[model samples]
Target: MKEIRFENVCKSYGKTEVVKNLNLTIKEGERLILLGPSGCGKSTTLRMIAGLEDITSGSLYMGDKRVNELPSGKRNVGMVFQNYALYPHMNVIQNITYGLKVQKFPKDEINLRTDAALGMLQLKGYENRLPKDLSGGQRQRVALARAVVKQSDYFLLDEPLSNLDAQLRVSARKELVKIHELYKQTFVYVTHDQVEAMTVGDRIALMYQGHLQMVDTPENVYNRPANIFTAKFIGSPPMNVIDMAFDNSNDSAYLAGQEIPLQEEWRNYIRQTGVKELAFGIRPEHITLSKTQLKNGLKGFVKYVENHGSSYGVYIDLEGNEIIAMSESNKWPPKEAIYVEPRLDKMHVFDKQTTNSIGYPTSIR
Candidate 1:
């Protein structure tokens, strides 16, 4: 069952729309990541689900019940804020049980839930420590425990690991998945971090400029992006998008005035689309930098190279456009003339006017 759903839901602050007409669904026990850059309304969308933000128009349903007018307390969702939202004066034990105390849950039940949460989150011996005294990871655990104690069917977290250092964030992510496994809930995580979204989310709902860009699994979001925004957003160096035009023949396309051959399936697809002006996209890792010209290679000069520790990024100047190609070795120096050949099967062609990818080869269907 779809545990949460939005139908044309929109939220605006007076004249400015914060969330545009949104149509999305969160499944019963799936972890859905609401991913986008800051001010893209991912947090606002999460707030709307928790009933903290009012839906200016349309319907929001939680398990067949319209929750547009529901109060925050009545919605019964457990949320962890970006700041962790732990009470400064309260100790870990008190902070985790405070919600249940307010709700008047029986003393014995509250103790049982608190014990379970504390043990699961590994805070058994540190219950006496106040939020101010705990480490960042410990504090985050306390905040998570507070939510876990509620045992709500819906779990929400907004940039929960953004405050931690790189290594701590990695460990926290694992804990979150572990928590979800112990008690399966409809998890909605909001983050600007693509790494977090790709790692923890069962599916990612990518948004941009208050619009739902695409909703797909991490693999599809990375490999088969719906539009230019998603193609550029999900990757580290991002996809290399170069201006291309269909040549007189369907078997080839022109990139930087060089005719590059297309695979038979891509040729057929582009020919079927009949769009002359095109934006060709390929991931950096899919591109190979060669010292000598190869078949279907575009000639370019090496602008510079960047060491990524594990891999090297070779920036090549294709006419006036700069494209990055990932290499295992950095043999080419500055100003070296080289060729870049994109994997034919990995190429993505988008309609220049609409900025939408022409669907993959029919064989991919």
Candidate 2:
């Protein structure tokens, strides 16, 4: 299987640019998810690889050869589109065998590959049903079968599970992974849904506003975000950010004019950096709420509570800033006074001016 590389790739239509200076490499035999919100240029990037979109500048490589002008049919890539893209008029077996037949494969060879794909995608008994007659999940499987029969070097899926219901999506994701293990093809998956990105990808390539933001394993992207946008985008409740000021004389940080109890190491790092204005971030799960005022705690009032099945999200108002803390249950009513405490090790600090992470300031003693 071949890997795909993008070197300073940019895509534009007339004057409006979509993908800007993208530099990323999808490693061989690994699943890489192109993840971001709508209009982030994720689908455009995928299309570029599929040769469906032109790269206005820079180079795209498949393995060692530049494939910037390769035709879609000659790229040795099997793609599943967001709509499943199955032929409405063709039955399951016909759709799966069409490509092989078009390529002039032997009749026996076509039947063998088509039958294998049908069994693999659990469409054994539905071979005679047309795409219009199949349900969303079944049509999706037919699309998968079509791609699978090709057995190309690169397998690309653009939000293939987006149209399925929740339960079907879960099973489809598993099937995709299983298929990857069997084929060992380089997989490029595109999705705006973070859950699919987290669960399916070997590494996630996050994009924003046509720029590639960060690329890393799902765990690093969640816990060690590169910037404010990444930190805020990965979580369900998101990370809470508060503007803070540092007092040089006292070697302390203040939030809403209340002195924060900064640990000695953090204070040392802060002093070393000399960034007077900082943005402090803590995830909802790392914040604790106390009814009684604890020493060095930040005072706040309960603004609201939301139940997320397993836990309660307690939103608190600290002066004008609103933040959330996850609790096992919702005991505090709205307007109740509360104190918020954050785990020091789990805290995130960012440069206020650039909105980039300072990287959990710490060093060997």
Candidate 3:
């Protein structure tokens, strides 16, 4: 296992910069995930670490050695691409042992490594099967087996489960976690799927338009977001952000002309920042919905309802803005207005101008 570090890294295409002044350290034997939408420079960042792309400016270190000028073959990194880049003519054993053979490893050592990979990946019975004859999940396993046999210091996977079906992807993800547990190698995975990132990564690095938004554990990124973009991007239905007006004179806050409960910490934050307007955010799961009005609640009409097998997603219209809430009970009165209230302790306050979250209360944090 090895630790990877990027110091003041920058990547550009002529005058167009795709990665800007990145500085991060991936700890030894850590599973770090790079997550973001397409064209967000995640794949580019991975390639740079693999020595496939040269850094425009800055230094990259693998453990104690500086590898900015090292060739990919000398970097001791194993890569698995999204398309399972397997040779169609080569069977499972041939594909897995090809790299060792090219490096001229001994016959006994090659056999030992191949056997271990096949048994660990659960591809023991399909050793002679060609890529065309195997299932999508099976092919993915072959790809992983190939990378495992190399026994490199670092393992890089770029959207390795994008091609599998939903059910198959779950199994594949579990297998991946198991493989990592057994090998304990440094892992760096890239994907745009939030579910995969939350489940597999020890720490998540969220990127947007060549900038690093936040790097932390999944729970912190979800509950206490650093900015408005992180709050909106990490959740499934996303956090509902409502524009609100703050009255600094009396230490009160209102949303759409309705007064909402304000905690002491929140009032202090508003007074300290001296901002008259801010964005109020709360996750759908954190909001409670009821047919009757509740204390410190906003009234709204039920606009639509979506049944999601386990829970019902209720969309309510408050004046002109829309708010979503989740409910375990699916039964609802037709065309009836419902009242929704956000948990005061779970609310998020953000600066209107910068779209960055203001500090939360100590109890909430």
Best by lDDT: 1
Question: What local distance difference test score does each model get?
Answer: 0.92, 0.91, 0.90
| lDDT against true structure, model 3 | 0.90
Report the Cα RMSD per candidate.
1.2, 1.6, 1.4
lDDT of 2 by residue, 338-360 (tens): 99888877888889898888765
Highest TM-score model number = 1
For model 3, state the Cα shift of residue 173 in Å.
0.9
Q: Which structure is stronger by TM-score: 1 or 3?
A: 1
List, in order, the clash count of every candidate structure.
Answer: 0, 0, 0
True lDDT of residue 247, candidate 2: 80
Q: How many backbone clashes does candidate 2 have?
A: 0
Q: What does candidate 3's lDDT look like per residue over 281-348, in tens digits?
A: 99999999888889989988888888988998888888888888899997665467888899988898
Q: Which stretches of candidate 1 lie over 4 Å from their true place?
A: 248-251
Q: Give the Å shift of residue 228 in candidate 1.
A: 0.5
User: Candidate 3: how many backbone clashes?
Assistant: 0
lDDT, residue 70, candidate 1: 91
